[model samples]
Target: MNGKQKQSYKYDKHKQRLFIIPARITSNVNNDILVIDRIYDDDDGRVVVLDREGQVKWTYQGNPQVNSGDKLFNPTDIVITSVGHVIVSDVNNHALHVLSGEGDVLTCKVMEDQGIIFPMSLDIDTKGQLWVGCHSGDDQRKDAKLHVIKMSF
Candidate 1:
């Protein structure tokens, strides 16, 4: 071995099949990973969570407390805030949904007016702000824009 100390870095390649849309990924403070479930035509889809060891914890399926009205869609991408709140991009309905730990809708708002057509992915910064990636359909995909929605809670 060289006299100089070798600073080594390594990453674990633990794979777990949880969500459909595996294009984007985010990690919580606890190293829990959140991935997009799938991409839909009209709205956001679902987000799945995986523990540090690459084990499925529990998925937040679009606010489990909200009663389905027969015209509701699931979440596309999810973000776990520093405060432990789950933020989801509810695409089909053209909105962003915030849920509590137990999967209850804490707040919901239409992100379409903000040029958010179909939110497909989400990312959270150190300051706890949400970065949203929207898809305006394949025809306009080349012009798709990224929306940054600042979380209040």
Candidate 2:
């Protein structure tokens, strides 16, 4: 293969087949691959965690209680913290969903109070803080902003 050519496939070892539609991906310190699978024509999106050997560890499809009205609609980005927590930016939901290493929903923070409209991307800094990039809710697109949130866990 040429240097510019790359190959990609979606296979789940446990299922013995290809099943993942990866939209965004990130890795933890332990090299665990965290993938966000965007499901078309459905309200349910998924977060799949896989080991280095392509073995499925755990999967999250959003918490119904926390995501009651909105759901995990259109997860744009994902970031894993040093401590193993998975944070996802839910653009349509206008919130950040925090999940445990085991795929349980720990907390969901609606950024409305913080002036965050459509959170599109996020990253964890060396100091373990979360920097979120958001677009304005206003149709004029004159109020985009970036928010820095101090993470405790």
Candidate 3:
């Protein structure tokens, strides 16, 4: 096993498994902490919020505020908009989920269509345009690509 070492880790003795532990991101909103639950269910992943000292603040399940065609699947990356909206990158679904700062689904936008496979990361530029990175699902050899979406005021 030749790779970089992890910061912290945990072991499940009963289950006979070892896991790399993750540190928490300090929320700029209120100094609370945030963590991502990488895998859940038979579909995808989700995000969980915690206090500064590691306490639950909030969490978003697969269900967005509005249920429609194709929900979030395996959310892998997240970002906060200038207007205080939660932008979650749903890898399996090849799209983005826009939510209120409090974790309420405001809207869902299909970031790509043609060959967009799995988006892994997201960010909002100073101009408010959305940027995305595509992983293996895209199969482009680049491992990732950049895209800009027109921002809606």
Off by over 4 Å in 3: 1-26, 40-43, 64-72, 114-116, 136-143
Per-residue lDDT tens digits for candidate 3, residues 78-127, read 77767777777777767777777777778876655656567777777888
Q: Flag regions of model 1 displaced more than 4 Å.
A: 1-60, 63-72
Tens digit of lDDT per residue, candidate 1, span 7-100? 3212224543444456457777676676665544334355666666666666655643341564355566677777777777776666777866
Candidate 3 clashes between residue pairs 3 or more apart in a chain or in different chains: 44-74, 45-74
Model 1: lDDT to the true structure: 0.65
Deviation in Å, model 2, residue 153 alpha carbon: 2.3
lDDT of predicted model 2: 0.78
lDDT of 2 by residue, 1-153 (tens): 567834344666545644436778888878888888877744457788888777888887665655776455567789988888899887777888899888888898888777887898998888888999997767787878889999986
Candidate 1 vs candidate 2: the lDDT winner is: 2
TM-score of each: 0.59, 0.81, 0.67
